[model samples]
Target: MKKTITIPLGSQHISLLEPVRFNFSCENEKITDVDYNVGFVHRGIEKACTEKFEYKQVGYVVARVCGLCAITHTMAYTLGIEHILNIKTNKKIDYLRILMLELDRIHSHLLCLAHTAENSGFEGMFMKIMGDRELVMDIQEAISGNRVQFDFVCIGGVNRDISTECEKLAFTNLALLDKKVDDLIGKFTSNWSTALKYKNIGALSYDDAFNFNALGPLARAAGAAIDVRAESSILPYKEVGYKMILGQNGDIYDRNLVRLKEIKNSILMCQNILSGLTEGEILVKFKGKPNGESFTRLEAPRGEIFYYLNANGTNMLQRVRIKTPTFSQIPGMVEIFKGSDYADAPAILASFDPCMSCTAK
Candidate 1:
């Protein structure tokens, strides 16, 4: 006779920062079925953007959608509005926008790597990554005046300009971060224990990734070769030397490697932006109300984040819609949980870097 058991990894857990629940049906340590819920932290930000806030204020409101990727959300919303308003921002504004966006990506990817390490019983690696992540955070604060919700991007242009001090600070810190991240890549790839916890675990094949329409590192790690930065022209990602990083095996290890490589790529992009800094006004005054519908897409740290806006040539918008990456990847995530050991669930979940706040919003 065979025995089967069920395990639930919570709507709240020490390993998770946000509210999400997963139930695993296991037979002799291998998972046979999986279920998940991502609605614990829904705050109705979409409704509030249309009902309560004006077009000018909705950018800031959407920035609160997820602190880690706040800059991405703000940039997406601002791009949609700029498209509707037909604002031709200068090159300097675009450069500065890409700088902040890359900085945000660096820090967000580090946090995800740290969380994955901690879940894999690598507390020391987690501490090292977190400590080094502060370098990027400091640069963010210096540039945008805040760590998480910078509110840097606006409808016409950026809210602030890069000063000489900020430029030097960014260059110096990125040099330091480059070295630390290289060390992390070494540890994640060469260390046997880390490889054991991560390699060949929670794998999603190329077929599965395509079938599920997965995005971000999850899809890239599976060799899906789909990246919004490469596909979408909404941002000047190509001007900043954007390259899509892909992996052959879709497992936790590959996911970590993809993120590490992306961090290096983001650092290079920031350096490129700073080196080619042109002179222009960071903010421009526009005198018309947004009167049409617009949509914009950008590559957030986790995946593609999209914003849709409908305006009626008034101060207030008629509708605001957000399609976050985590929400779209839930089906893929559930599929990965199947056929894996129940004990490996936490590490697998961490590798996906699921953001419940972004999903439920």
Candidate 2:
């Protein structure tokens, strides 16, 4: 008889950045079953948004859901509120929003790639990716006055406008990032060692992805062709040449490739935004309190993040619900782990880029 042992990863582990605990039941060296705990980082932000903060302040409040995709969180919430208020923002505001969104995507995808490389025992690639990621961070800071939690997006429009100096800085840094990302694409695609560790490992098929309702990179990697940016009209994603990147294998390597290609595409979108930016107001005024239900969706770094809001014509909102990508991908995550080697678990998890804070919130 084969004896099975259970291994626990995280709740506090080197591979994980947030509080996510995974219990893997292993038969010999293969994972047979898996369980995960995501409530360890729950902060009750949903309740707090409606109870503690007013409607206008909820944008900044939801931005705390996750530091990496804070812009997406705020933008989704603001869009929901704007929907409730029926505010039509100007083209300049929309362009600025897309610029920041793509910047966030670029940095977030780089971080995921770096983490995947580090987990796969490629420390040098990890360092190189990390170093290149700062170019995007620098542009983000130059535009938003902060690196992580910019709070740039708000109801009606954005809080800050891009200046000529900021535009110059953005273009310069993006050029550097574009070159580095191209190099990364070559390395990830051509490196044999990367393939050995990543190819055919932790693969999720299209059927499995659809059955599990996988979102974001995981779904795209499986050739699911589901992206909120492409589906939703909330933003001008079509106008900015947003193309969905897909993969055939849906393994760790495919996930990395999808992210790399996404970084390249995001860079193109940012360049387009900067080159043809129109002159208009960043923020528009909307009167009266929110009094209806509304929802909005946006493609975050990991996947699609959704926001639902209910208002009662008062200072405080009635309800705020957030359905994050990581949370939705949990089932798909567990499914992928069932047949993989225990040793490859960390690399697989890192590829999914699970954000427990967003899940537990």
Candidate 3:
């Protein structure tokens, strides 16, 4: 019998962007069993949201759950509160919210692609993708007045409207970013390191994905048709040309391809949103505290993010619960680690784009 040894990937590792730990039981170089820990970075954000912050203030507070998807968190929390309050947002508000969300998706996906490239020893490609990601960040800053943590969403609607200059900046930068993404699609497909080597590494089967309850691109990459954007009507996703991009294999290559294709789709949706901007107020005035319980689901860059709120007709909430995609996909991620070479763990982990902060919160 081959000797079995255990190795730990992270709680703090060079290959990890988050504080997640993975223990791999390996026989020779093949991973035979896998265990993970995602609670290292927990900050008690949920506790604070329900106990300290009021209903209106919770939107900005929840935005701190994850820097990459700050807008997603805020939007989900805002929508949940709005649902309890019976607030009806107009067309322009919906469009603006979607615009910020797609832009957030573009930047987040590019960051994941960059991380995957770096973890796979392609530092040059990583740098290039990061540079291209700045275009999207610039557009977001122009619109939201912040780069990473955009507290742009509120209870009823958005905090700001797209101005003429911001619109011009969006059109110009998005046109350039679209061309760069096309080039990236070509490189990701043809490059030996990003494409061939990653083809069958760390693959998750469709059945495994379904059985494990995978969400977002992780599930879609495994041939599982799961996406909150397509399933939920919380936003006007269908009106803004939202398409669910899927891949046959759940390997690193397929995950990278799924993200690249989604970035292209998000860019198109952003353009469509800008071109079809409706005339209305971004933020609508409202009163009365939310008394009932409400929940919302949104498709974040990594996966589906869920928010549940229970209010007691007061300023503070009784309970605030968040079910992030990475939290749900941990089992699916561990399932993929088995039967793979130990050397590929970094690349595989990066492809999942696990957000520990969001999960822990």
Candidate 4:
């Protein structure tokens, strides 16, 4: 006969960056059951978007949902409002938007990888990756004048245009970051601890991923053919040389590799956007209050971020709803926790890159 005990891992654990709680049922060293909770950091941003802020101001408010994914939140909200108003932006707006988006993805993925390394006891690698991540952060600051919570995207367009000097800086820094990413690929793939120790740890099968509706790198790491970039025409992703990346084993190692490849692909897309630059207005002036409901989806670094907006012929929106990737993938995450080693919980959690703030918002 075997005995089981329950252990709690969050809501304020050192391993977590935000407030999320997990209770594990364990027998000896192995986990037998799991319970997850994520509302500790909830700030009522969705309610504020409808009642406290006007439609135009909601973009800025929602941008605070997650600092790592501010641009995506603003973009998704803006696109939803634009859809309701039936406004079609020009090529230059689309190109510049894609540039910021890919840059956001680059930094977000690097941060996740660095945390994963740190969780696995590779402090040196964590520091190296964090240091290199500054390259993309600098580019974003040079373009938008902020490192985090850029407030770059607006209801009709972006806040500013890329200057010649800024574009030159982006090119130079991205080239350097490209080389750094190649080196990271080598380290994550060939290093003994990062590569071997991660093998077969916290794995999710392809069928399980599909059944649970896993999104972003989690699903892609399990070889599930699900990606908003490949499925939707909401943005000009296909025009900017975007390609879907997939992994075979669905383990921690596979998830890390998938992010590395995505970083590489995002670099390519940013370069393409800059190379095929167009000339036009970044913002379009429109005079009308929103009157209908609209839904929009954008691929954030973690996965597909969705927005729903409803307006009743006024400046104040009737309702605002957000469905984040982390919220959707909770089922898949709980599934991965079962039968995993209790000692591996932190590393496995880090590998999933759960963004509790975004989920709770």
TM-score of each: 0.97, 0.98, 0.98, 0.99
Which one wins on lDDT? 4
Candidate 4 wrongly placed segments (more than 4 Å):
none
Residue 246 CA error for candidate 4 (Å)?
0.6
Candidate 4 clash figure, as a count: 0
lDDT scores of the candidates, listed in order: 0.90, 0.90, 0.90, 0.93
Query: What stretches of model 3 exceed 4 Å from their correct place?
Result: none
Candidate 4: worst-modelled 10 consecutive residues by lDDT: 149-158
Tell how far residue 276 is off in model 1, in angstroms: 0.8
The TM-score of candidate 4 is 0.99
| Candidate 1 displacement at residue 287 in angstroms | 1.5
> lDDT for model 1, on a 0 to 1 scale?
0.90
Per residue, candidate 4 scores C-alpha lDDT tens digits across 101-123 of 99999999999999999988889
Poorly placed runs, candidate 1 (over 4 Å): 1-3
Clashing pairs in 2: 216-303
Q: Tell me the tens digit of each residue's lDDT in model 3 across 1-361.
A: 6589999988989998988888899999999999888899789998998888887888889899889999999989888889899899999999999999999999999999999889878999999999999999999999999888888988788888889999999999999999999999898899998888899988999999999999888889998999999999989999999888999988889899999999999999999999999788888889998899987899999898888899999999999999999989988888888898999989889999989999987
The order by descending TM-score is 4, 3, 2, 1
For candidate 2, the 10 contiguous residues with the lowest summed lDDT are: 190-199
